[model samples]
Target: MAFITKTHQEEALAALQDLVAIPSVLDESQAKPGQPFGPECLRALEHTLALCESLGLRTFKDPEGYYGYAEVGQGEELFGILCHLDVVPAVGQTGWKTEPFTPVVTDETIIGRGTQDDKGPTIAALYGVKALLDAKVTFNQRVRFIFGTDEENLWRCINRYNEKEEMITAGFVPDSKFPLTFAEKGLLQVYFEGPGSDQLALQAGGSLNVVPDHAEYQGSEAAAVASELKKLGYDFQQQGEGIAVAGKSVHSKLAPQGVNAISRLAEALVNTGEFANPILEIVGNVIKEDATGESLVGLFTDEVSGSMTLNVANITITPESSRVGLDIRYPVTLEKETLVKALGEVCAEYGVTYREHDYIAPLYVPLDSELIVTLLGTYRELTGDMTEPFVNGGATFARAMNNCVAFGAMFVDTPDYLHQANEQWPLASLYQVMEIYAETIYRICCK
Candidate 1:
């Protein structure tokens, strides 16, 4: 509250409203040479960088459309505030009271996609730095806001940024909740393939990071599958020619909290005793309803980030080939190869060979580091909250750099609506978050 004013709050909120108005979801169909992720992501990046320039910061838009940045101050040490513009697709997600892309502002809240995920927080941090600059505060280190374009997908944008942009001395990803996050679980996405049976065909789910909400299969063998799902007491519905098995959808990192619709369907199919797909058998018999990697005999558990979680993200089966995708978040202290090897051992029994689709190594920073100390001190001084830094299965831009961690955008009471239906931001927290960022930046970089 010290650095930001009512006028500044109005300006910041207006900026966020304008940003949330854009439906900047990843669209590969409109992808071109310079716009690798798609036109929307490129547009979002361009818009965000332009906003930064409008705020009187030096800005640069990447020619390849993978990333962008805005900066102020001059020093050998560079402080980064990592943010992303691209958000998860919101069109099909249920439970929206207003249009997902249309920013609906009330007296106390703003409802829109990307509001709480990253965009709203990004604007808060931007104005936070702008506050110090406007007050003519001299920075002892360079402060830069690195805009990422493909954070919801494979992180190709930030990967391109790391390949092309200058590395920061240290920073925080404004994309996550805090006190602060000191560790993150390792993320592993694997694609398993096996021989396909011409007798059956199936396909379900999307976005390797989101657990499917409904496995509505509308193909061959509907009656049998439905009968089995009913006998199994699974939540499902009959969809004319097929059946839809219902599951609670959530981010893959929080798989323990969600139900895997794809797995549900697979279980029903296997129980039918009519389907002979090896992949389906594995999903039903091997991994059945287990989020804690219990199928693997608890091979992936650690004290820092807790037990490994698995989500049957997607599946596709055909006569030519059978494929299934998995999203696994292992502990930071666990060995990746050991877990990978254990998975392969079990999967190989069904003639299913596994290949890693993507892998992000875990992130860990000591609680006593200068960056942690400064950010934590700033947060405590502002809120009087003594909650220590913690770890989770979530992955953020904090993994993009060595000295970075995820600092608070959400306080203790803020519900996490990131990547969820009806994502929203509380208006009351905006000024406080901006003030926190302003103060944190001052203590960490300006001083």
Candidate 2:
């Protein structure tokens, strides 16, 4: 029997619309004492908690505004469903049919920043719990919908939540693909710094996890670089003595899908012999058009987690120095020490300093585990998908704890627009996930 009905879908849709309307992108400038993430993120958290409370569930908002949860049922053991309220920045992105934050509901889909990534799934899971509660289904364990505020940046909210809250026995995060994700690659965010040229100033890209879509270089050889860009058929504009190149943007996890403007600009500068030696060495030797780590350190691959991927996500050049940010997703079989050693050698040879910003160890749950079996069975029973569980390069909340993995919200063979412009999710897919969540919650918590 379907656990989610038309009324439930309508309610969930309404809740998602309200949540999507808030531009909950993290803003460091708006950070305060209580809301360390930012004002918009706090508002999104407060709104979600309020909605959960209105649904007759007990809720908790961390005093420091790091994380929050909505709870139902009563038991010593807790089963968690983790989701996030904050979204990636969409302020200056292009190709949106409407405003990025405005919820556009069509006959088939809901389009917005968080619609596909998390906010829609969060509301769907909430209503799933609401359905179970409305039906008066008894449960032997507690169910919690944990919400984080800094998922797009660092995972501070989840870290803080674990520090203060009770540990959940088993759980799933609805932020990845369906048929279950049993393994995830390790994540490493590294930064490289080197001396800069006084004759050139360069800046491009935004987040460390996104491919640079725009870049500009201003200096003595700007005109030569601009002429080279014209010959290369790039869309460029002259700004003062600089040239700005526009390229396609994509998630760092899929860096090969987009043209990185930073790399393009570097190529132009190198061809014109205007870039500094350090910059020339790093760009011409370390980074390349391909996402594979072949040109940087070395390539690592495994049967379970696939190959290593490296993305040059952000770059900035000033009169004094230049910094290049890289996002690397490595396979589980590789040792962190070995990778770091190789990177250090490369940096030393290029006359640059390297520092790692964040590191997330790989997550691999055995396929024969009870949690994986149960989630896979539930997905198969609901959607009849027989595809085997797979691995990915992206990190999720599931990596924060044991006995947890990412389950559903995205299905097999579906086009992923999670961090891209015109982010969207099918309306019917929401109801489908609602039914699956309700069944899984009932099976895990009630039975």
Candidate 3:
């Protein structure tokens, strides 16, 4: 029997549209007292909480707009459904069939910035719980849909929520691909800075977790760099002694797949010999095009989690100093301390100072655990997919809670458009996810 019906799908789509209409990108400039992330992000949280309230679910907005959650049922043990309301900036991205903030619903898919990345799955899960409520199903445990506002940035939203709310007993996050993620790699964001030259000024890139799509540098050798860029068959142009290079952008987890604009510009700078000495050497020699960390501090790989990846997400050069930001994902089997020490050694050798920003330790749930068994069994039964649960390079809200794992929202064969232009969520896939969440909620909470 179908767990989510036609009415549920309609309601979910309507809710998704309302949430997607707001440009909830984090802007620290607009941040204030109650709105910690930004005004738009806070607005998205308020709209979602209101929607839940309209649906007869008890909702709670964090005192300081860090996070919010909607609750159903009554029990001491809480089963959480974690999702995020904040999205990455889409203002500069091109090739969108519709405006990035405008939700476009066609016969097949929902097209927008936050559609597939998170907001779509959020609505689906909400409707899934709504189905159970409308059916008057009793539950042995409570279900709470927790929404975060700073997922694309530092995850301060969830951090504050954890400090304030009671710990969840067990749960799943619909933020990654199915058959379910049993393990996730550790994440490290590091900054490297050193004294530089005044003759050159360089800045480019966006979020530290995304492959830089564009980079520009202005220096004494801008003309030479432009010539080299043309010779190398790169898309570049000169503007007032500055040359800009355009490259494709993809999630840092899949860094190997995208052409990094920051690295490309760095290579040209090295060739032109206009940049500072060791800074150019570090960029040209150590952090070239390879996504693997082999060139930086060597590589770590294991059968369970796969190889480590590194992305040179951003770079800035000024008269006083030059700064480079890196986003690294290491295998679950490796220790964070070991990786950090190795990286520090390499940076010190190049006369650059290394500073750590944010670190998320690896999350590994035993494949044989009851939580994995239940979620994996439900996924296989619903989709008839024989693929086993696997490790992921991407971290999720699953890591923030105890005895939790990332489940569904994306299927095994679904094309990944998260954090890229033309982000989309198939209507049929969302409906299917709603049904799965409905059934999973019943089995985990009601039974």
Candidate 4:
């Protein structure tokens, strides 16, 4: 009576369809009225927990909106599988071939916002757990699946989970690339304010982590800026009170090196003869240096997160002030104080104010650890693919646990469109991931 039965596969597909049907994007509109984490995220978390309950597994949930479980198993030292149900926002007009939230099936690929980034694998892991349970696998350790609601923006949900849950012996997160992830660069969010106030009209980007494919701004003085960009072959759209600047959407702001919308807007301003604003000038300087971390202050790069990235996600201007939110993913090896010192120097130079908010230091587990070997072995056994464990810049809940590493749901060759328009996952890969999870759980439990 193993969990990997045909019945389990049927349940897996059914659960995936159900999970994808819920438009679980972290709605920004809910930020001010309800929880800082969106209600949709909370709903997704509940849905996941209820699914766990239906599978006949013991579960744990805190009022603060995080949950975990001791799946049907027996072991003293718990083995953890960390994953998240929350996802980034998806704009409808972002040129999605299919509606971003609607789960579409084309050529065996399940397409939606969370399919590749996390939600698909989250369900896959659930079925994997089911497989292990149904198999009546016996072992010397407990297997717990930890699901959080805020992995898209911040990891507060997991932070809270660790505060109340039991420490895990070893585990992996199915949220990142396959093979394995041994290192994750630290994360830092830098907020900057410049001298321009009341006179500036602006709009560009959303979410510091995402590369904005479209953004623009307009004011009484916007014509000059628009005209300048037009000369560069940039087309600006006049929508509502502002303009829309467009660019291609991409992921992992560090790699692929896509054009940043905020950076592009700042460049437009500087080139359009609007550099009179000291704040705008400072922004230009910041981009020119391409500095995203504290290393520039001392001229040494932080190696863990690699170089810092300046993802100027959101911008706002009032009659009296202008501010920007920068998502800076820091190197794990760099000291937090070093980043602080770097910010202090930059702030002093531009006369712009700066602040550090939502800092998550990097998490690295030794590549040769038993937990890693076990997870890697499970993956290799299930897929017969020999891939090495590596490092990634994207953060996951795996780092939130005492002994954990991110496993896989996304194949190294397949494009899942995580955080991009028309995200998706192949059904074959989904089944493969479930089988891998089942093996990982079973091995970890038995050993």
**Top candidate (lDDT):** 1
lDDT of candidate 1 over 135-236, digit per residue (tens) = 889999999999998999888988998998899999999877769898998889998899887777788999999988888777678889888888888989
Which segments of model 4 are wrong by more than 4 Å?
Answer: 1-3, 26-44, 64-76, 87-117, 153-156, 192-252, 255-287, 290-295, 302-305, 310-327, 345-353, 388-390, 415-424
Residues 1-447, candidate 2: write the lDDT tens digits: 567778899999999999999999888898988899889999999999999999989999999999999999988888999999999989799888789999999999999999987998898889999999888899899999899999998899999998888888999999988877878888899998998767667777789889888888867777899887776676888999778888788888777778888877777777676556675457644575657777777678888877888888887778788888889888777888888999999888888999999898778888889898889999898888898887872578999877889998788866789899999999888889999999999888988
lDDT of 3 by residue, 196-252 (tens): 767777778879989998998766677888887776677887778778888889999
Against the reference, the lDDT scores of all candidates come to 0.87, 0.86, 0.86, 0.70
Query: 363-440 in candidate 4: lDDT tens per residue?
Result: 777766887778787677767888676777356777676567777878788874878887888888887778887777
Per-residue lDDT for 121 in model 1? 93
C-alpha lDDT of candidate 2 relative to the true structure = 0.86
List residue ranges in candidate 1 displaced over 4 A.
21-23, 27-29, 37-40, 87-114, 196-291, 294-298, 311-324, 344-352, 387-390, 415-424
Could you tell me the lDDT of residue 357 within candidate 2?
A: 96
TM-scores of all predicted structures: 0.76, 0.72, 0.73, 0.70
Worst 10 residues of 3 by lDDT: 272-281
For residue 135, model 3's alpha carbon misses the true position, in angstroms, by: 2.7
Of candidates 4 and 2, the better by TM-score: 2
